[model samples]
Target: MRAYERLLKYVSYETTSDESSETCPSSPKELVLAEALVEELKQIGVADAHVDKDGYVYGSIPATKGAENEKAIGLIAHMDTAPAMSGANIKPRIIKDYDGADIVLNEKLGVVMDTVTFPHLTNYVGQDLIVTDGTTLLGADDKAGVAEIMTAAAQIIEADAQAGEGSAHGKICIAFTPDEEIGRGADRFDVEHFGADYAYTVDGGMLGEIEFENFNAASAKVHIKGENIHPGEAKNKMKNASLLAMEFNSMLPPAEIPAHTEGYEGFFHLCGMSGDEENAHLDYIVRDHSMDKFLERKAMLERITAYLNQKYGEGTVTLNMKDSYYNMREKLESDMYIVDRAVEAMRENDVEPIIQPIRGGTDGARLSFMGLPCPNLSTGGHNFHGKYEYVCIQSMDKMVDIIKTIVRKSN
Candidate 1:
């Protein structure tokens, strides 16, 4: 079957991950898709295919006779969608030969994707685009990648079977991981058992993005306690924790936030906050491409917390900070050849390679630190994790060809 068909099938399983869950997969529904993938893998001639207890699916396409000595390479994509949006009951619509105009997702609700909001729509004017209704996300983030890899694997398996001995290039390993949206996708990954010299995550955007570096990330939480008193009798004795929370937020640099930063610049993003007069809470995510800057950003938060405590009687404010992942550039520097292979593969297929640093983290970033030099490849998706999410069918087909080219050229 074609990659687009497979993608539509995969997205129908409602695999949105949960961030608050403590389970390995983070969500029980992810296993439903994992088991389906195992069945598909076995049907495609990958005899050793199975889903681990943690909901990670692993499969291998063994090398043909004479190519057994070639190094094994892995292809990976996550199975879960981000928890930021609803992935359930997704109603996808196909636009054949897009007209480069505003797309009306929900006519009654007045949900429209205009040119002003998403300029990238103009780029795919004459292509087949798969989009979603305004109510639910399309789940194209990594489902497109999953479909591309599956289609490529089927082709490789068929070619090798037809040619018999001494025909295929090398062993190709494929893995479908869960909970990447919550940053636990690589926590239990078995790199040694995967047995690949290198790997590529088909988990990027656009048609030719090849990313090896990503942001160094950390999460921070702030809790504040205040002395609440009746407003009518309030004087200097009353301390409002909600007002203190706002003051703490004001202390951060106004320009150094996610909305104002781009490229290699760093930012402190306030993801959520809730509170009242008695107590308040703040949640933030700090990110930077440079380790020194990353550390400085975290320190700045701690410094702010210290000053607040000193002013509010030493126990009014508390801070909790923890590192999530680091930049993969330090680990990938020695393995430039892996990046070159992907670039060459893209160029060979008439696709221009756009090499850039990722503003966000991927499963490959954490896996790289764990003894695997993995880079990211594009899955032909755009505007991921929202209702505007979409993928180009032609671009997905090109990605399948690029994966095949990478495997053939690497061997």
Candidate 2:
């Protein structure tokens, strides 16, 4: 089957990961998709395909006879969709030969994707676009990547069979990870076991995009403790935690927010916050392309917490910061050959290579730090984690060819 068909089948599984869950996959439903993918891989000639206890799917295609000694390359994609939207019962609509106009996702709900807000729609004027139904996300973020890799692998297997001598490629490793949206995709990833000299996370946005550098990420959880008292007596005795949380938010530079930042610019994004007069909590994610700036951003949060604690009490405010991932550029700098190969693959496939810094982190960034030197490739997805999410079917087909080209070039 084609990549688009595989994508349509995969998205129906509802593998939306949960951040609150402590399980390795973060959601039990992810295992269902993982098992199916494993079976598919085995049918595609990856005889060793299997899903691990953590819900990570792994498979390997051996090298061609003459290329047995060549270095192994890995392709990775996440199985779980983001927790920000409902991935269940996704009713996707295919717009063939798009007219470069606004798309009506749900006429009854009056939901539409106007060209003014999404100028990128103009780029895919004549292409087939797969979009959501204005109710749930389409889950094309990495599902497109998964289907592309699977189709490419199947093609390679078929081509090798036709040769009748041996395979026509080097060793190829494939992994479908879960809980990538919750920032734990690499937590239990057995990089050493996967045994790849280099890898790529097919988890980027847009076609022709190649990313090796990403944000140095860290998550901060702010806790505010306050004394509750009657409204009439609240002035001196009561310290409203919710108001304190707002004050804490106000202390940060309003200009250095996600909406105000772009490119290599860093930002402090408030992901979730909730509170009451007795206790309150704020969850923030800090990101920067530069390590120095990332540290500065984290330090700024610490300074704000210290100032608040000094005013309220030593233990009134507590700050907890944990590093999620670092820029993969540092790891890939000495291994430019990997990036060069990807660019050449795209060029050979008639796709322009758009090398840029990723504004967010990927599993590749963490894998690179874990000695994989992994970069990121596009899945042709846009407006991820929302109801209006979509992918270009033609772009996905082209990506399959690109992956095959990369594998052939590696050999």
Provide the clashing-pair count of each candidate structure: 0, 0
TM-score computed on alpha carbons, candidate 2: 0.90
lDDT of 1 at 300: 91
In model 2, the clashing pairs are none
Span of 10 residues, lowest total lDDT, candidate 2 = 161-170
Candidate 1 regions exceeding 4 Å error are 164-167, 225-247, 274-279, 309-316, 409-411
Task: List ranges where model 2 is wrong by over 4 Å.
Answer: 164-167, 224-250, 272-282, 305-316, 409-411
For each candidate, the alpha-carbon lDDT, in order, equals 0.91, 0.92
Write candidate 1's Cα lDDT for 34-118 as tens digits. Answer: 9999999999899999999999999998877777887788999999998999999988899999999999988988889898888
For each candidate in turn, the TM-score is: 0.90, 0.90
lDDT of 1: 0.91
On the 0 to 100 scale, the lDDT of residue 197 in model 1 is: 88
Quality of model 2 by C-alpha lDDT? 0.92
